[model samples]
Target: MTMLRTMGADRFNYNVFKKKMSKEPLYPTQECSYKMRIEMLDSYLTNQKTVDVSSYFKPGHLVIVDLRDPSTNASLVIALFKIIVGLFVKQRMETGKVLLLDKAHKYLNSDPCSARFTVSMTSLIRQQQHFGIRTIIPTQEPAVVPDAILDLVFFLVLHCFNFPTWMRNLRRHISVNQDRGESEGG
Candidate 1:
């Protein structure tokens, strides 16, 4: 049995050696290419669960927040924001650079004030900025965010605004116009 196994191994090795020596490539050959066809399986599979937000924020990493849609459950959103802010604060304490927050106003809305999560998240944003951590907030509705928070933004990206009030407020920080001539004039 050992001798037979040795012979089989030797034969396999010789076949591989001969194939390498041949002009044809080892993979995707004319004779064996049909066997390499990948079939798409028609089977039901469970949807992938959403990732925990905590794992996303590393020390000294820049983050972009897109909270365009209002949250169904405000409490969960607030709790998540608190955890992120805490992580950023800890990271900043250890390292001088801060974790930046982008598009913060959507999650930190001020109107109605019924959403405890939005209020808490807004407070956290303010606190993080107070500790000398940089935060950049981009929003279409600047009025929804507090003036104190808006004042801290070092950089501003003003896209074309449809509302006059938004246009007026944006003009104070950055230039906004329909045409090149108007932009230069403003």
Candidate 2:
């Protein structure tokens, strides 16, 4: 027993272990969640790696929602999103690392289960600023995003203003509410 203890004694350095497991700020400052657009100039370049952007993300660090496979169903994505969001919120409240969800529309959709989760975003709005739960969703067609998620967004970053007529009308309503200093439906 003494020999075994001596052999194992060198492996357990509390200080080093603590530092490795410390729940400190893991991601870079100011680069929270975002939706990025990748434009491939040529058809051959579609599968090529344009840039290595992995440094921005930490390993075992970000919860990724991969719905690229055709077999991946909406129900599964909805369930996963709900779980991931809860985890992200808990981590944000405990630590300070905000999780990023790029192209959230891919994961969250208008399915029945997804709609149920969307309704839960009301509570999320209340704790957004407190827990630093920031989400950046970019879509060419904004109609794909659920209206519940839109209500919680305080800032809007539109790269192009050439919106469809329906979207323009929606923007008009949003602008009116903003001008009156109203929190959407709140």
TM-score of each: 0.44, 0.51
Which clashing pairs does model 1 show? none
Leading candidate by TM-score:
2
Candidate 2 lDDT by residue in tens digits, 99-157:
45566665456767666656655467657777666656676667667766776667776
How far residue 64's Cα lies from its native spot in candidate 1, in Å, is: 7.1
* Stretches > 4 Å off in candidate 1: 1-72, 92-103, 111-132, 170-186
* Cα lDDT, all candidates: 0.47, 0.49
Q: Can you write out model 1's per-residue Cα lDDT over 48-97, one digit (the tens) per residue?
A: 24323334555656565433334234434444455556545544344444
Q: Against the true structure, whose lDDT is highest?
A: 2
In Å, residue 140's CA in model 2 sits off its true spot by 1.5
TM-score of 2: 0.51
At residue 82, give the lDDT of candidate 1: 52
- How does residue 144 of candidate 1 score in lDDT? 67
Model 2 lDDT-worst window of ten:
33-42
